[model samples]
Target chain A: MKKDELKKKRIIWVIWLVILIISAYFVPFVLLRGINQVEASFLYWTVFAVAAILSTIKITTYWSD
Target chain B: MNSFYVYLALSIYVLIGFYIAYKSRQGMKQGVIEYFLDNRSTGGIVSALSYSATTYSAFMMIGLAGFTYSGGVGALGFELIYLAGLSLVAFFGPRFWLVGKKYGYVTPYEMLGDRFQNKWIAIISAGTACVFLIPYLSVQLMGIGYLMNGLSGGEIPYIVGVIIASILAISWAVIAGMRSVTWTDSLQSLIMIVVSVIILFYVIYTQLGGFVSFFGRLETEYSNFLSVPGPGFFNFQTFLGLTLPWFFFSISNPQVSQRLFIPKSLKAMKTMIKGFLIFGLVYTLVSVLWGFSAKLLFPGLQQADLATPTLLGSEHVPLLLGLIAMIGITAAAISTVDSIMLTLSSLIVRDLMQSRDEYSDKKQLRIGKFVIFIIAVIGIIFASQQLDLIATLSVTSSVGLMIVVPTIFGAFFWRGATAAGSLTSIILGAFTALYLQFGNLSPLGLAPGVWTLIITVVSFISVSLFTEAPKKKANEFLGYLDKELEDKNIL
Candidate 1:
């Protein structure tokens, strides 16, 4: 309930979102190109999606009221 | 695929929907709020399913599968980001709920009108939504038309498809308003995911030789599908352009944003968010896999959109499953179109027509019902035009809606946000998108969606600084909200 705590938590989320977007975008483009295996970008994105969902679950646990 | 089966199944589906609608109205309260919003008391499970049905549409199975059939892995990334964007609800949901409860706001635009202290803001936003959404709604009807006609080999006329969709959508929506829509949407959402997933595994196991060979075949045979810019359709810019507008889709699109107001409590909303995320992930994977199967089984088709229809009609899937999947796709389209109509009708009634203290709830609900019917007719006319470019039609619908995002974020986060900023963003942003789209011009080689977001956000901030902020109202509105959220630990 403290002002600083709310501000901190929100800032953490914003930063996480920025990092998530950057990784989801360029990392797959940069890291996974030319890897034709199903384990390439397909697997990368699956892991990426599951990771995003898990992170969201962690954040949502803090929701109350 | 006989026309008789399509006719018979649809008739039975309509009867079941109507029976559910009739039952939903058993002890319904009378008023705009009750009709439009289920008196803000929808339970978590129904809310979750209805929200899923409303947010997703025929696009997932038919359109998204086709996207994967052509574009490949990028489709999954594009859609998963939208799910990740559900994190936005974690921040915005509680805020919207608190304000709606406190102000008795019937629509998101009405809330914005009050927040910005300008009636014109509400009018412009509600109108802009219609400009984009009506065509989008028409696209859903066209999906039905194409599905029914395609499956029946044109024995069923296209007009019949549109009429059937309109009747079901309009009836489910008007029959018991949100309650009927929600109940029916719950059923439709289940059928959509269930039927599609079943068909997915059926194809994988029976035809493609199960998970190991199915995925192994894709790896060896269609390896281009495993990475970015696959097959030259989803280059980086194209991916961002498509996903960016859709990422904001949750709050910018009024139909979904209004769902933020329907859950009876914060706990219910938490459930809604969790349910939608899991449903969305599973459905996205299902559609993508369906597309991959299509690519592997029936390659070299002239059109990517043919992937779904081709698969459904193939000898691989059983006739009964194929028929049920067709009905599931129809259900998906109807659920989406009806939700849009109900929200747009509320917007027209509350924001555009009625003076705040002048109209009674009975009169408003009466006009609301009438507006819904007219909206359905206009939808029929639009669908009759037959705009068939799937990617263009899909992305274009979200472009104008994206114009509202900055104003929304500014309203909630920055107290300096003003009505002038909201108007400038909506008007100029829409103009930019329309010009770029019609002229086939994307300055700097960026997409219209990317440009619209940039212009709208820049304009909103710049315009708000020059205009006067409604200081007292902002304080009273936001001051109360911050404290309430803090007390509740919502952040």
Candidate 2:
């Protein structure tokens, strides 16, 4: 956890984070195309739930010692 | 007009609220940490749910429904920024909590006061919180009244509804202070999630026939509603208006800051933030779908704000829908009212009631309860104005929190920021928000939230850089910042 390495790691993590956020913008349309309202809502929420869990892991592992 | 049951249900709800408050009084704590931040004993589930309940209120369901129905769905882009705002807030939670613990910074203004060595800034901030929060609080009262009147078949008067609602909210705030609000919010959050799911399912079933039919129907019947704001709906100004100020506001708001102080560990902080993000995404999608259903079912409604409850109350749904709608509205209103009351109570007691070191824990708790009672009375008076709940709410909150951008940024980033810089920003931001909201003076039809942010930022930056930084408290201020962060393991 030297200064340069820490800075480099943060930059890489931030880049991936941006990609994840952009991907989320398309989630509603993808899920909404399904046949039933309940199914669609469940699908959309599932994607959201997964993303949240992934981000939480990334934050903890990266930011916290 | 089968609104009689709405009134009866509401009456029973308020009575339960009073009982909860009365019951929680026995458990009131004598320590500051115990009273304000729940002794950091709040579990993950309770913390997550309380955050969601406090974050999304009648403002989200009723108020935002009006905005989407009238302003179109493109306006929902504002919500996307919230995902980022909330997540960032979560990330910063550990740092803020650590700092708060080290310096005894219970309220947001305490941080400001310590940063600038200026008590006036804290006083102004606490004052702004009180003034802006009352109208916002009134909106919750009005929403309760609306539900009561709509449900009771016009049997219960709006004034009685207001009193019943206020007393219930004040009672809750009084007994537990933050502790009761946290547990009650957890309970309310569960109710909101269940009711929200039920409404989404029923609306999709009755209106669109099913999931497949809903999207197909949306494409054909409400194509414009689903499209992103581009052609005539969104412009550069609107995009700037909706997104930028909201990002700044979310981080700076006192209620959100209060959340940052509650978590005990970094892990707890991350979980809470992630929970809120998921909640925001689900809640927005379900609420928007409900609004779209409103569009199709009642094409010629006078007010778009009433669309959700009206559609729920329509004969197509069951008696259960009416009951859930009543509870959903109540859940949203109570969650918001409780949080606002907590914020108002803290601001009055900690920042205004006594000098910083002179205040005792017991005295602060007493003053907090007293402030809650005062706010409840004022909210009742405001609810009698015959204004729509959402409009009054947005205008008032916009005016009150307009200083958030400058004040918070100045605190964290601007090393050269001065008391005068904060003062000018507060004065300019408040005036701009007030003029746009009350005097109809948003420059070239801009949203007041946007106008205020711009004014505050310009004033704060210009004043800070151009003028000399104060010499008196420079070393002490730096020491405070260093000590606050070092102890918290932030850096």
TM-score of every model versus the real structure: 0.98, 0.86
* CA shift of B171, model 2, Å: 0.9
Alpha carbon lDDT at B172, candidate 1: 95
Least accurate 10 contiguous residues by lDDT in model 1 chain B: B386-395
Error of 2 at B248 (Å): 3.2
Under CAPRI classification, how is model 1 graded?
A: medium
lDDT of 2 by residue, B1-491 (tens): 45556656666665665565566556556776677777766666667788888878776667566656665554455555555555456345665666676677788787777677788888888888777778777877888888777666677677777787777677667676777777777777777777877887887886679878876776666565554442244344565565555554456667767877877666677677667767777777667666667777776778878887677668766776678667777877887787888887787777775474687787777777777888887788788875654355555574458585676666665678888888889988887777776765558777777778778989998998887766456555555655544443333
Strongest candidate by lDDT: 1
Encode model 1's per-residue lDDT on B1-491: one tens digit a residue: 89998888788777888888889999998988999999999988899899999989999988899999999888988998888888788889889999999999999999999999999989988988888888889889988998999889899999899998999999999988999999999988998899989999999998999999998998888888888887878898888888898888889899999999999998898888888888999999999999999999999988998899999988988888888999889998999999999999999998887485598999898988999999999889878877554335445878878888998898788999998998999999989888887677878889898999999999999999999998888998999898987887766
Model 2 chain B lDDT-worst window of ten: B227-236
Error of 1 at B400 (Å): 0.7
**Model 2: per-residue Cα lDDT over A1-65, one tens digit each:** 45455446546656765665544444433434222333343344345545644664555544452
> What interface Cα RMSD is found for model 1?
1.3
Q: Candidate 1's residue-wise lDDT over A1-65, tens digit each? A: 69779889889877987788778888778888877777778877778778777776666677676
